[model samples]
Target chain A: MARLGRVLLLLTTCLGLLGTAGCGDDYDGLVIGVVLPMTGPQATYGEESWNGLQLAEADLRQAGTNIKFKLVLKDEKSTPQEAQTQAKTLMELEGAHVLLGSVASSNTKTIAGAAKENGTPCITPASTNDNLTTGNPWLSRICYKDSVQGGVLATFALSNGWKRAAVCVDNESDYSRGFADNFKGAFEAAGGTTHFEYFKAGNADYSNVIQGVADANPDVIFISGYYEDGGPMIKQAKARWEGKPVIGGDGLDSAEFLTLIGDAQNPIYFSTHFAPDAPDEPAVKAFAERYRERFGKEPGAMAALGYDVLFVLMDAAKRCANPKSAAELNTAIGATKNVKGITGLISLDNPDRTPNKPLVIVKVEGGAKKFHSTIKP
Target chain B: MLADVLLDGLGLGAIYAFIALGYTMVYGIIKLINFAHGEFFMVGAFVGYFALRDLGVDEVDLPQPLPILLAFLVAITLAATAAALLAVLTERLAYRPVRRAGRIAALLTAVGVSFFLQNLAVQVWGAGARAYPEPGIWLYVDDLPAKADADYKIRERVEAVVLKGDAIDTARKAALRAEGIERVYRTPDLTKEGKQGFVLLALLLWTPVLWWLVKRTRMGRAMRAVSEDADAARLMGININLIVAATFFLGAFVAGVGGVAYCATYGSVKPLTGWIPGLKAFIAAVIGGIGSIPGAIVGGLLLGVAEFAIPALLEQLGWADAKAFQDALAYVFLIIVLLVKPTGLLGKPQREKV
Candidate 1:
C-alpha cells in the first residue's frame, strides 16, 4: 500500500510538469511572421516585398526603438498548400504574434484562413480581393480592395470620356475576374458599354485576343491580368490598335512589364497603390528614393505597400497593452487611424480593416511608368 | 480576318510540329511515350535565352541581316546541342534500365523523369518568366488599313525603309538611326511573317532529311530492325542501345529548334513554358498516328489551325467566353478524333493474338 501511494504521487507530479510545459506562455518579445512567394511565378512581387521589408527593418533600427521583436520570413513558393503549411509553422512553431504576406489573393486567402484558426493577426501587403476580410476579424489588408480600384478606374475612364471599353481578363485568376467583373459592373452602371475578352495566364500569344478587342473598336481597353501577360498583350495591342488607350488595375505594375513593353510609346495606363513622383506625397517620394538607394531598382506599388504594412504593424504593436498577445495587437491594428504611409493616409477604423487609400494612375511613356494622376477614394 | 487567323495558326502549328516530331520519333523506336520530351524543349529554350541574354550574342556588331541571322543561328544551335545532350543522358539513365520492364513501369518512370526535369529547371533558372531578347525586327503588316491622316504621318516616319525596294546605304541607314527610326522598324524580310516562314521552312526541310535518314541510311535500317524486335536485333549483334540513344538525340535536337522558335515568337521563357505546348504536341503526335513522322506534321497543323480558328469562329458568333473554352476545345477535338478513328489518322491496325 505504501509503494502504491508513492507511485501515484510520482504519476501526478509528472502529469503536472507536462501540462505546465504545454502551456508555453508567449515569447519574451513579439514575433512577426512573413509569408511571401520568394520563388515560383510570383517571385518578382515577393522579391520586391522582401526588399521593402528590409528597408522597413532598417528604418526601425535607425529609429532605435526599444521594442524587442524578431521578424521571420518563409517562402510560400506561390502555392496555396505551401502557404498554409508555412503559416502553420510560423504560428505554432515560431509563436508569431502577427502575420504579413502573400502578394496574390488566392494564396493570401489560404494564409488568412490559417491565421484566423490560430487567432493570429494577418495583414496582406498587396492582395486586393473584395471578399478577403468579409467575415474574418483577424484578416486585413494594407492596400485598397478590388472594388475600390475597379470603381476608381471606371470613374477615371468616364472622366476621360472613354465610353466604350473592352476589358480583357485572365480566366485562371479569381483576382482578375473579381477586379474585371467589378469594373464592368461599375462602368455599365455609369452608362458605359463594356466588351469582355478572356485569356489564360502563361500563354505567349495575345494576337487573337487583341484582334477581337480591335474588332470591338472600343475607345479604351482594360487589361485585367498580371504583368506577365499584360505587358506582351499591350505590346501587341499597340501594334494592332495604335491610338486606343489601354488601362489596367494594379496587376500590371511590375518591372517585367516595362521590359516586355520595351520602347512601345503607345498610351498605356494602370492604377496602382503608390506613385513616387506624385508631387504632393513627400513620404512616397522619400520612400521611393530610399528604396532605389537600397535596392537599386524602381520600387513598384507592391514594395511601397510592403514598407507601409510593416510600419503599420509596428504602429499597432506600439499601441498594444501586451504587444506579445496576438488578440491585443489585432485590436490595436483595427483601431488604426490616420497612419501616414507611403501609399496614402491609412485609416482602418471601419468595419472591414481595408484602408481608405488613394489610388494612383501611372502612364507608360518613354520606357518608364510616369505618375499621371491620383484618385481619392 | 480568316487569313490573319490562319497565318497565326500556321505559325503556331510550326512550333507544335517541331515538338511533335520528337514525340513521334521516340515512340517509333521504343514504344515508350517520352513525357520528358517537353523538358528537353524547355531546356533548349533556356539555353537559347542564356546565349542571347548573357553570352553576348546580341552584342555582335554585324550589320543588318547578318547580326539577326547570326543571333538566330547561334541561339538555335546552342539550344539544339543542349537539348540533344540532355535527351541522351535521360535515355541512358532513366529509360535504358526500364526498357525490359513492363510498359506501365516505363511510362511511370517517364513521368518521374518529367517531374525531375521541371523541378530541376525551377531550382536552377527560378520560376519567374524571363523576357526574351527581341531581335529588334519589327513585323511589317502592309494589309493593316491605313489610319487617319494625323496618325499616318507619324507612322510614315517610323515605317520600314525596305517597303520602298531601295537599297539602304550605310550612311542613309546611319541617318535613319540618328532619327531613331531604324531602331523602331527595319528589314522587310525579318518581319514576323518572315521569322515564321524561316522557322517553318527550317522545320519543313527537316522532314525530307529525316525521311532520307530513316529510309536510306544504315542507322535508319538498324533503328527499324530494333523497333521490329529488340531481342532479335540484339541477337543479330546490333547495338540497340546506340540506336535508341541516337533516336533520342535526333528527336531532342528538333525539340530544341522548336524551343527557339517558341521563345523567339513569344518574347518570354519560363520553366513551365514547355508543359502546355508539350502536351499539345503530344496530342498532335497522337492525332497524326504516334509512330508516323508525316502524320505528326499533318496532325500538328490540323490541331493548331482548329485550336485557334474554332475560338475565333465562336467569338465571331458572339460567344464572349470562347477563348475561355480554348484549352477545353483542344481536348474535345482530341476525344472526337479518338472516337472517330481509334488507331489515329495514319496508324496501321495491329493484329491481336487471342
Candidate 2:
C-alpha cells in the first residue's frame, strides 16, 4: 500500500508537468522557424516547399514591408516525432514568432501540438490532414483539408450512384487514415457502403489486398496511399482480376506512379490539390511562370502551396497590429478571407477553420492525368 | 475467393522459399543468421532491372518469344551470378574472419553488412522504386502509352481488344449451345497460369538437384563434415573455408534468382522490397527446420498458401478487413509450428555435444 501510494504520487506529478508544459513563447520582429524534411524518402517534398518559400521570401522582401523577418530553416527529416523535436528546438532555442512547413500532412500533424504547446503560431504550407485544425487555435493550414477532398469524392460517388466501394489505405500513414476515415464517414452518410484493405508504406506487394477487394467486388476502389504503393497495387490487381474503376486523392500524384501503373487498362481517378493545366486564374498562371523561370522546372502542387502560403502569412501578419505576437497572428490567420491562392481562394469563416476551396479531379489513364471536373464546395 | 487466396499465397510463398533457402543454408553451416541475405536479394533485383534497362530488351520493340526469352535468361542469370559474387565477397570480408569470433559478433557484422548494402543502393539509385523495365514480349504488355495524347487512343484500343475477346467468347458459347455440346473453356490467362506453372516446375526441378548436391557430391561431403566439426574436418584434410565460401555463393545465387523473379512478377523493384519477404523467409526457414533445404521449400509453400488464404477466408467469413493483418498474422503459423514441432517439420533435433 505504501509502494502504491508513492507510484500514484509520481504519476500525478508527471501529469501535472505535462499539463503545465508547452506554454511559453519568445518572439522577435520576424523569425519564422521553417521545419521541413530536406533529406529522406520525402526529401523531394521538403526541397520543393523550401524552393517556393525562398522565392516567396525574395518576392515579399521586394514588395517592401515595414516588417522585417528572418526564416530559420530546419530539416524535420519527414517524421512527426522529428518535426516535434525540431519545432521545440526552433521555438525554445531560436526564438521564433511563427513556424512554417513540413509538407506532408502527417508531418504537419506532428508539429501542430508543438506549436500550441510553445504558444507559437504554426502554419503548414502543404499538409491537408482533415482534423489538423480541429481545436488547435495556434495551428492553421494553407491547403484544403483531407475531409473536404473526401467529402467531395463522397459526393461524386453518390451522384454517380456508385453505392458500394472498397478502399486500399496505407495503414502506416496518418495522412491516409484521416482521408480514409473522413471518406468512410461521408460515404456511409450518403448511404454508400465502403470497406478498407490496408498495406504499409514501402510494402510493394498488394496481392492479398487486391484479392480481398476483388472478392468483395465493390463497385469502385479507393487507394488512399502515395503513388509508390498505389501504382503497383493497381498494376498487380489488373494482372489478376478485373478491378472496378479505382479512385484516389493527391497522394496518387507522382510521375513514378504513372510509370509503375504502366499501361494498365483500368479507369482511374484522383482528386489533386492543383492541376497545372487548370489554373484558378491569371495570377496563378503568372506565379507559375515566374516559379518556372526561377526553379527551371514545372512547379508541383507542393511548391505552389509553399509560395502561396508565405504570401498568405505575410497578409495575415500585416493585418495583425503586433505581428510578432503568436495570439494576434493566430487570430488574423483564422480571420483571413478572400485571399486568392495559386490553388484557389482561401477563407477561414467556418468554425472548423477548413479552407473553402474546389478540388480538381483528374482522369489517370495510360500514364497521364486529364482534367475531368472540379468538384466545388 | 478461397481459390484466389490459395493461388496468391502459393505464388507469394514461392518467393519466400527462394529467399529462405539462403538464410537456412548459411545458418545451417555457421549457426549464424545472414541478415545481409535480404540485401543480396535486393541487389539481385537491381541487377536484373539495370540489365534489362541497358540491354534495350525492354525497349527494342522486338517481336515475341525472342525478347521474352532473352529477358528471362539474361536478367535472371546475370542477377543470380552477381548476387553470388557479392555473397562470396561478404562471406570473405565480413563472415570469414568472424568465424570463431562468437555468434553475437557474426550477427552484428551481418547487420552492418546489411546496412552498408542498403545505403550503397540508396546512394546509387536515389531512394525510389524503379519500374522493372518490362520486356514487352509474350503476354506481358510493358509498353505504357506514355504520350500525353496517347491516353485516350491506347485506352480505346485496349478496351476494343477486351470487347473483341468477349464477343468471340460469346459467339463460341452460342455455337457450342446450338451444336448441343456442353463444355466450358476459359481463355487461359497465360500470364497468371503459365508463369506460376513455370515457376513451380522450375522449383521442383531444382529441389532434387539441390538435395543431391548436398548429399552426394564431394563438396557436399566437405560441407557436412565442416558443419559437424570444423577442426576435425580441417585435420582430415577438408578445406573448411572453401566449402563455406561455396555454400554462401550457392545460397546467394538462388536468392538473386528469387529477387529477379519477384521483379518480373510485380513489375517494380525497391531496395526495401525484399526485407519483409526476407524476414518471412527466415521465419519460413525456422518453421521448416532452419538448417534444412527441403524444409525451406516446404515451409515456404506452407507459409505462402497460409499468407494469402487466411485473410481471404476471413474476409469471406465477413471479417472484411482481415487481409490487412495477413502479413502479421502469418507469424501465427510460424509460432504454431515452432510450438508443435520445435525441431521443425523436417528437422532432426540437434543433440548437445555433452
Candidate 3:
C-alpha cells in the first residue's frame, strides 16, 4: 500500500511538470491573446471589437493555411492596472506570443510596457493616444495617432478659412490630452488662435465650459473627449451656441453620441479610421455588411480597426515557418508588409513597428455619418 | 447662470429627497442600513420602463386624462408593490436568520443581498442599457419654451403673419391646386403648461392623501410606534412585521413615483442609472439627520444645490482649473455638516437610558 501511494505521487508530480513545460513548446498553431474591457462601463466597445476580431479569425480559417489561429481572450475591465496584470498573465500563463488589445490609451500604455518587457509584439486596435507607439518598438497599432487626427482637423479648419478655434479637453484621459495638445499645436502653427478649457471625465454638465467657449467667440470649437461626455457637451453647446461647429476626434464615432445629442444639425465633425461610405472597396464593404449582419447594427471605426488587427496578425503568421516559437513569431510580425485592410493599406514603416495607416474625416449629417475625405500618411 | 444652476439643483434635490425617504425610514425601524435599497430603486425604474414600453402603456392614447393617469397609476403601483415584496423577502430569507447577529454580519449580508439583486436584474434585463420610453404626455416637456419672450414672440408671429399669409396663399392658389384651402400654420404651444399642470394637480391631491394616511390613520400611529420602539410596539398588541411591510410599501411607492419622475425629466435610463442618485440620496439622508423625515427633504435639496453651486463658486473664484475637485463637493458638505451638527439640523439626539 505504501509503494502504491509513492507511485501515485510520482505520477502526479510528473504531470504537473509536463503542464508547466508546455509553456515553452513549439506549437503548430498560432495563439494570440486578446485583452480588452469585456465587461464594465466600456463593455459595449470591447464586445464590438471582440466580434470584429472573431469575424477576421473566421476569414483566416477559410483561407486554408497550415497555421491554425487560436484566440485567448482576457477581460481588462477598462483599467490600466488590470490591463497590465492581464498582459502578464497572458504572456506567462496563456503562452500567447502576439497580443491584440485594449480600447483605452491608458490600458495600452501598461500593456505596451508588458509586451516590451516580454519581447512580444502587441498591436492595439483603437488606442489613439500618441504615446503608445511614440518610442515603443514592440508596440504597433492599426489606428491613426491623435497627432495625425489633430493635424487633419487643423488642416480642414485652415483650408475652410476658420481663423480662430476654442478647445475643450478632458484632463484625466490621455486620449483627450494628446489630441488637445496636437490640435493646439497644429492650429496655432496654421495662424489660428485657440481658447482652451479643461474638464474632468465622467462629468455630465458642460454648461460652464460651453459658456466660456461662447464667451470666447471662436470660429469653431474642438472638443477632445470620449462619446459619453462628448454627447452631452455637444447637446448643451448647441442649446447655448446655436450654429457653432463642434469638431472632435475619433471618440465621437458612436451612435450613442448622436442618440445623446438627439440632433444631426450640430455640425459635429470627427476624424476616424474608416467611414461606412467611401471609395467602394470590396474589403471595406464586406466588412461593414458582415459586421451589420452579425451585430444587427452598423460597425464603427474601432470595430474596423479590430478586424484589421487580426488580419495583420494572420498575414504575419503566414510568412513565418511552421511550428514557430515566440521569437520567430515576433520577428515575422515585425516584418509585416503592405496589407490592405478596412482601415486602408497597413504597413509597418519603422523598425519600431509603427503602422502608417490612413485617417478619414467624417461629419454627422441628417443623423447619419457622411464621409468627407481621407488623409494619407 | 446662478439662477439656472439653482433651478437645476432644486429639481435634482427633489429627486434625492424622494429616494432618501426609503433609506431613512427603513433604518429608523430596523437599525440596519439596507444597501439593497439602490437595487430597489433600479428595479422600480425597469418596471416603469417595461410598463410604458413593452406593455404598450405608452402607445395607447385616450380622449381625456383618464388613460394617462391610469397607466401611470398602474405602473407606479406595480413597481411599488414589487419593491415592497422584494424588501420583505430579502428580510425573511437573508436577514431573518442573522437578525440577532452582530452589526458587521448584518452589513455584510446587506452587501451580499445587493450583489444578488444587481446580478439578478442584469440576467433578467440582459447586460446592456435599456431605454425607458417617455410617456406621450412627458415627451415634449423640455422642448417647451421657458422664456416668455420666446414663447409669446413665436405665438404672435404665427398668429399674425404665418396663419393669415397661409390662409390667403391657400385661397389664391386653390384654383391652381385641386385641394381646398389648407392652412399650414398649425403650431402647438411649446411652453411646459402641461407638466406644470400635472405637478400642481399631484401636489394638491397626493399631499392631502399622504397627510391623512400618516397623521390621522391607525396604521400611521402603528408605524410611528414601530419606528420609535419595535419591541415595545410588538408588546403593545401591534404586529411588528405587518407594520414594517406597510412602511416599506409606503416608502417604495414614493420611490416608484421618483423613478417615473427621473425618466420623464432625463429622457433616458441605463442599467446603472440608479447608482449616482442612490449614493447621493444615501448621503442626503445622513446629512438630514438620519432618522428625521423632514431632515431628509432638506438634506436632499441642500445636496443638489451644493452640487451645482460649489463648482460654480469655485469657478468664479478662479479655481476652475481644478474641475476634478467638483465631484468631491458633496463629501465636503457632508463632512462639514457632520462636524457642525452631528444629529443634523432638525434631528433630536437620543439619550441612552443605561
Candidate 4:
C-alpha cells in the first residue's frame, strides 16, 4: 500500500509538468495572415514571396527575440473576388492581427478594402497601383507606386533627348493604364510630345498600331504591358521601326523579353523596384545570393519587395508594446519610417498607407539586364 | 480604318486556318475531338527550336541557306513523325477499346488525355516559356543594294580663268551612310512575310497531294469508303483498321505542320501555348460544319478574321474599350453561324432514309 501511494504521487507530478509544457513559453505567439495567389497565373509571384517571408521568419527566430511568429497562409487565386473572400476569412475566421498579401494590384485593392472594413492592418508586398493605399489608413506597401515608376521612366526618356514619344498600353488592365498615364503625364511635363495607342490584353497582333506609330515618327515608344504581350510587341515593333528605344514599366522585367527579341538591335529599357546590378547593400547582396542558391535563378522585383515587406512588418511588430491587438498593430505599422530594405529605404510617409518608394531603371543588353539608374521621389 | 482592321484580321485568320485543318481532319474521320491536338503544336515548335539550336543557328549568326533548309526539313519530318506516332498511340490506348462506346466516354477520355499531355510537358520542359531563335537572314532584302550614292556638280569656267574639280565626295559619303543605315534597318531576321510565303507554298503543294490521296489511290478510296460506312466498308474488304490508322497519320502530319508554322510566327512556346489556339480552332471546325474538311479551313479563317475585326470595328465606333470584348467575339460568331446555317457554309447536309 505504501509503494502504490508513492507510484501514484510520481505519476501526478509527471502529468502536471507535461501540462505546463503543452501550454507553451512565456511569450504569446504572434499570428500574422498572409494572403497571396498560391495557385494560378500569378502563382510564381506568390511562391517567391512566400519564400522571402519564410527567410525573414527564420532570421527573426535566429535573432533570439522572445516574440514567436505564427504565419497563416491563405490563397487569393489571383482574382479580386477570391482576394476579398480570403482576406475576410483570414481576419474573421483565422483571427489574424496583421495581414500581408496579394501580388497583383487589383487583388491588393480588393483585399485592402476588406482589411479596412475589418480594421485589420494589411501590407502589400509587390502591388504598384497608385490608388490601393492612397486614402486607406489600414493598408501599407513595401514597393513604389505606378506613379513613381511611370514618372521615372518618362524622365529618363526626356533626359535622353527624346522629343516625340508614343505610348502603347494594355487597355484591359488597370496596371497598364495607370502606368501609361503617369508616364504620359511625366513625359509631357518634361516638354515631350506624346501620342497614345491602346491594345487590348491578349490581342496578339500589334502590327497595324505599331506601323501607325512608326509612321508618326516617334523618337521613343513606351509600352505598358506584361511580358506576354510586351515580348511580341517589341519583336513586331523592332521589325517595323528599326533602332527605336522601347521603354516600359516593371512589366518588362522578365528575361523572356530577351528571348523574344532574340538579338534585335533595339535597346529595351524598363523601370522596376530592384535589379541584381544595382548598388547592393549587405542585406540586398545576402538576399540575392541566398535566393540564387535556393531557386537556381535570380530573383525579380516581386521577391525583393516580398523580403522587404516581412522586415517592415517585423519592425512594426517590435515597436508595439501590445502587438497582439489589431488596432495597436495598425498604429505601429502606420508609424514605420526609413526602414533599410533590400530594395532601398522604405518610408511609409502617409499614414493613409500610400506607397512612395524609389524606383530603379534597367536596360536589356546582350540578353541580360544592366542597371542604369535609380529615381527617388 | 475598316481596311486596316480587315487586313489585320486576314493575317490572323490565315494562322487559324492552318490550325483548324488539323482538328477538322481528325474529327471528320474518327468523330472524336482530340483535346490534346494543341499540345502537338507545342511539341512541334519546341522540336523546331531544338533542331535549329542544335544546328548552331544563332539569332545574329545564321547558317547558310542550304543548312537552314536542311534544318527545317529535318525538323518538320521529326515533328510529323512524332505527331503521327503519338496520334496512333493515343487512339490505340485511349480510344480504340472505347470506339463503340458513348460519345461522353470518348470526350472524357480526350479531356483526360489533354491533362496527361499537359502535365507531362510541364514535367519534361520547365514551366517557364522558351524563346525560339529568330532566323538570321532576310530573304527579301538580299536583292536591295547595300548602299546608294548621290552626285553634286561644281561649275567650271575653263575659258575665263580657272577650272574647278567637283567636290561631291562629302555628299556621296553622307548619302552612302544614310543608305547603309536604311538597309540595316529594313532587314529583319525573322520575316513574317517570308513565313507567310512558305505557308502559302505548303498549302498549294498539299492540296494536290491530299486530292490524290483521297480521290485517286486505293488507300484514299478505302479511307473514303470507311468514313462513309464503316460496317459496310469493312464487309467490302476495305480494311477498316488500316484506313483509320492512315487517316490519323495524315491528320497528325498536317497538324504538325500547323504547329511548326504557328511557332515560327510567334517565336515563343509555352506549356499552355496550345490551349487557346486549339480551342479557337475546334470552334472554327464546328462553325464550318463539323465533319467537312474544306469547311474547317474556311471556318477557321473566318473565325480568326472575325475575332480581329470585331474589336477593331467596335473601337473605331467610339467604343475605345472594345479590346476587352475581343475574346468573346469568337463565341458570338460561332453562335450566329450555327443558328443561321446548321449545315455550315461549305458543308453538305446528309440525308437519312429509314
Tens digits of per-residue lDDT for model 2 on B65-146?
5666677789889999999999998887678777788999999989988877776676577555667766543221212122
Chain B global fold similarity (TM-score) for predicted model 3 against the true chain B = 0.78
TM-scores for every candidate against the unseen true structure: 0.87, 0.82, 0.82, 0.78
Question: What's the TM for model 4?
Answer: 0.78
- Which of the predicted structures, 2 or 3, would earn the higher lDDT when compared with the native? 2
Q: Model 1: what TM-score for its first chain?
A: 0.91
lDDT of 3 by residue, A190-264 (tens): 899988876655443455577778778888888898776676566546546667888888887877676566432
Per-residue lDDT of model 4, residues A123-183, tens digit only: 9998888888877888988887888888888889988998899888776688999988898
CA lDDT of every candidate:
0.82, 0.77, 0.71, 0.72
Lowest lDDT block of 10, candidate 2 chain A: A19-28
**Residue A164 alpha-carbon offset, candidate 3, angstroms:** 3.9
Candidate 1 colliding pairs: none
All candidates in order of lDDT, best leading: 1, 2, 4, 3
Q: List the residue pairs that clash in candidate 2.
A: A22-A117, B9-B304
Candidates 2 and 4 compared by TM-score, better number: 2
Sort the candidates on TM-score, descending order.
1, 2, 3, 4
Model 3 regions more than 4 Å off? A1-28, A116-119, A134-136, A196-207, A210-217, A236-238, A322-324, B54-97, B113-216, B322-324, B350-354
Q: What share of the true interface contacts does each candidate keep?
A: 0.39, 0.32, 0.08, 0.23
Interface RMSD of 4: 18.2
- The DockQ of each candidate is 0.22, 0.17, 0.12, 0.12
Among all windows of 10 consecutive residues in model 1 chain A, the one with the lowest summed lDDT is A18-27
Q: Report how far residue B306 has shifted in candidate 2, in Å.
A: 0.5
- At residue B12, give the lDDT of candidate 4: 62
